[model samples]
Target: MSATSFAIETRGVTRVFDSRKGFLFREVSRTEALKGVDLAVEQGAIFGLLGPNGAGKTTLTKILSTLLLPTGGRAFVLGHDVVTDAEWLRPRIGLVLGGERGLYNRISGRENLRYFADLYGLPTAERERRIEEILERVDLSSAADRRVEEYSRGMKQKLHLARGILHRPQVLFLDEPTIGLDPKSARETRKLVRSLVADGVTIFLTTHYMFEAEELCPQLAILSKGRIVARDTVARLRQLVGGDRTLEAEAYGFEDSEVSALRRLPGVSKIIEEEYGPRTRLTLRVRTDEIRPDDVRALLPDHPELEVKERRTSLEDVYLDLVEEEAH
Candidate 1:
């Protein structure tokens, strides 16, 4: 697609931060937060950006939202240059970073939306109507009159969403929008995101949750160390694992010797263990073309009962493989 066809575009964009130390805080070194990153987000598409912590997701979002200037290259939102045309661009896009701290604790949710609407220059009558509409859409109408401080984390997150879309922006940037919400709340938020995209709002979402990205975004990019390591549809990304099968087993009272024994299996290439109180979850990677569940079972010393299942490749597997390869 042409550059103008995208709602958000960046070319060789870079951001650098000066690290300082000592009492005077003299500049000691420069760290490259974004290293010539390039991206194109199609209009009305939900594009997911996945990365580990400090991978420059927030930095890129800030530059696109015009909250921070890129040190090199260029970015355009809705065809408006992010740096030079920020005044014209701000009203066309909205940003919702994770956390409830952005809302005013002393004010009602309705009031907070009203304040942002006013900033967007929505007339009195239009502001009231928009506020009501957003509150209903985000399912926060019941809590509109209550002070924000009295609301729960999920409620606060919904309010943040309502505030972001209060002006009906053409593009929206969501940075870990469901970070601290419960499962139900996260599902609700994802539904809202889909509804917004259906209404023609372009969504640029940053998340660490692979399943969430796979469910919401048709296309995604994996960023590692300020650069994109992989970008494609979730299905294509999963193909990076290329025929590798995953064997998952759950058991109680797993000894370290058993884990070591499992690692020695013929086809087992990698083992990841997660402990859930008294139970242990083991995910084993079988590198062969065909998955041999018997191989995994053969290594298990008959002790506590174990439940095992086999599955195809997943986005998490692809992401881990790419990031690990990049590190090497």
Candidate 2:
């Protein structure tokens, strides 16, 4: 693919860290944070990266945003090489890392943004104007003068986003932007993200919230153990894991023969067994309407307490199935 076609692209991008343990006799250990990750994101879109903890989600974000360099392979933002053309990429990209790290607690919200605006080398004449605009955009205008130390968790996160876009970056990297936010704040943050995309900024988001990714990103990649295990739209991902529908059967227990019968039923592609105290839950990935709760009940006649249900396959189901498969 042409480099100019994608807002962000990577080929075999890898990062490894080595650290020594012990005080006197130290032994060096290596951890591979990212391994041969390849990705492509279109401009003016929100691309979601979902992964478990320590799965290199943040590491990839840092590399794409030019904050950390990859140990091997290449990365590009807006067609500029992350390693060789970092200087050119920096001014056009924005990064809002997760948590409370990049802000000064002693300063006001507006002051925090002013500091970042200056660092971004925004046009001297338009610096204050841009800061105000960003604050207003992030809905922090009323709390502009409040010290960051006193700002709520949500407000601080908004300030981080304001600082990130102070220079009007074409591509924004949001690393778990709503990690610690309340439901209402998180909803507002999601709204803000949608607006940013509407304004023509490409967003690279790493989020643990399955619903958030499903809601905001039209395209998604699941990263596990530093590798891209799956990349596709949510609907397609559902099919990859199983199908569009999920059938769940719960009872105290099931005979081996009963499970085999369910597996033999038409449209049943996969069945996952789980034990909960004295009861067991069997989850079936059904691809067709041929299998119903009554059909499952007919197969397991011995269980008097059997309860069967059916629902659409959710993104969480897809994520867990992929990540767990990678783990083994």
Candidate 3:
């Protein structure tokens, strides 16, 4: 689907945290949480907003969910302008803000869903059907009557999640839905999301885990320091950040002196590395236009004993490159 028809679309959407003074008893400060961020999520696609903490994911989500207004730019959710049509837009979207109290501790899971369903104006029969479907889908059927206060963190997260999507919103904004869950629970949650997407539900995900982005989102935007530095599919993004033929490999017993020598080698324009004991794993942005493998081999005459091999680039590598490049 064209991005314009997508469930969520933002154009130069900026959120400036206006400076506010604290009470007379405290000091105050101001910070710009989001800086001219732009993004779009295709209808029915699982789109990811990947960034570290405070990179503006929550700020952006709040703006889109109508919980906060942007200081500048434009944003539309389900074809409704966030600022102008917030009242109408709020019902068509569901949002879960990582871990927060979105439910009543005294309420049972089923009661919670019914409460949300009624709040969303779902008809009685439709509400029953929707609640049943969602409870089963999120695997909460067996404990549907359990009080939320008695639930574990993972269980509570599931309830809040179920409640968010209970009304069958056109857009689901899940901010770290699997944040504190164990590895298995996280995977199961991701799997359920994928199933929902396959059933044509639109999902907007914000996550700190890069692999989660790679797994769930066919389209994604990488936010760095409150701005998008890379946006595309898993493969295209990897290629965008690191062109074809990026040389990456692990080697053992590499000395600090060898790092400098490798930087000077032919076909190597930039040295990307992380130390591993005596060796260093490095990614070299190959300069094939200027120097080929033959050229690199020619330079290796200076260090024939070194262990090195070329390999393809991964999304993790591409992500690091983009973020680090921006930091520089």
Candidate 4:
């Protein structure tokens, strides 16, 4: 697709942070936060980015949102270059870096929204009206006049979101939007995200929640060790990890020779071993319908205590497989 068709795009985007340490602060230590990362997010779509802690998710989000510049390549938001056209992109884009730090603790939530609205250059005639609408949309109208320091974590998150979309941005960047929310609050936050999409907003979401990503994002990319390890729909990602069908077997232990035997079974593509207290669990990724849980059970007939189960491969499985591979 063309540049204008995508709300966010990156080419060979890289970021390296150099810090001085030790005596006289002469020692230079380098950390590569993003390495040759290339990505494209379609307009009006919710694109989820999944990664572990310190995996460059925040670094890339900062770059795309114009909060920080890349060290090596280019990034664009809504067809505008992040580095060269940052001023133009800022108003068209909204960001909720989700936390307690952004809001003013001394003032009321309504006052916080008013402050941000002024910064976004909202028309004075419509500023109060817009703030009220946003407060209602995020279900925070009743608490709008309350002090921010007294707000719950979830309430603060909603206010952060309220401030983000108050300017009616075309693209929104949400970094761990539901990180510390209670279950009910997280669900409500997700519902609000859907409503924003319905209003023609393209969202770039970076989250560690697998269920959230699966539920909200039709397309997702996994970033590991500062690189795009995989990018696709969850269904396609399952195939990449191995297959949808997964068989798990547990026993006290399995001989190395027995594991090799399981690997030779028809449709078995990958085997992961894990230890649970006294028992050892072997998870097999199977690609064919011909292989049944009983089929796997027959191989471990020697272990009378062996237990076998079958289930579908989930997004968490795909994420672990890809991220683990990158770690090696």
Query: Of the candidates shown, which would achieve the greatest lDDT relative to the real structure?
Result: 4
Could you give the candidate ranking by lDDT, starting with the highest?
A: 4, 2, 1, 3
Residue lDDT tens for model 3, 1-328? 1226768888887777756566786655667777888888878999998877778898898999999999888898887788889989778889888574778889798998888898889998788988999989889999999888888888888887898888877888999899999888798899888887877889999988878888888898888777888899988875676454566545554455656776876656577778877766666776455644444444445555445556555667767888777677
User: How many backbone collisions does model 4 have?
Assistant: 0
Q: In candidate 1, residue 107 scores what lDDT?
A: 88
Which residue runs of candidate 4 sit more than 4 Å off their true CA positions? 1-4
Local distance difference test values of all predictions, in order: 0.87, 0.92, 0.79, 0.94
List model 1 lDDT by residue over 1-328, tens digit each: 2236679999999999987788766658888989998898889999999999999999999999999999999998998889988998888899998696999989899999988999999988788888888999999999999999999999999999998888889999999999999999999999999999999999999999999998999999999888999888987775555435788888885778888988877667777788989888888877675446666666775744888889877888888878877777
Query: Which candidate do you rate higher for TM-score, 3 or 4?
Result: 4
TM-score of model number 3:
0.85
Count of backbone clashes for each model?
Answer: 0, 0, 0, 0
lDDT of 4: 0.94
Greater-TM-score candidate between 1 and 3: 3
lDDT of 2 at 286: 90
Predicted candidate 2: what Cα RMSD to the true structure? 1.4
Runs of candidate 2 exceeding 4 Å displacement: 1-4
What value does the lDDT take at residue 97 in candidate 1? 88
Backbone clash total for model 3 is 0
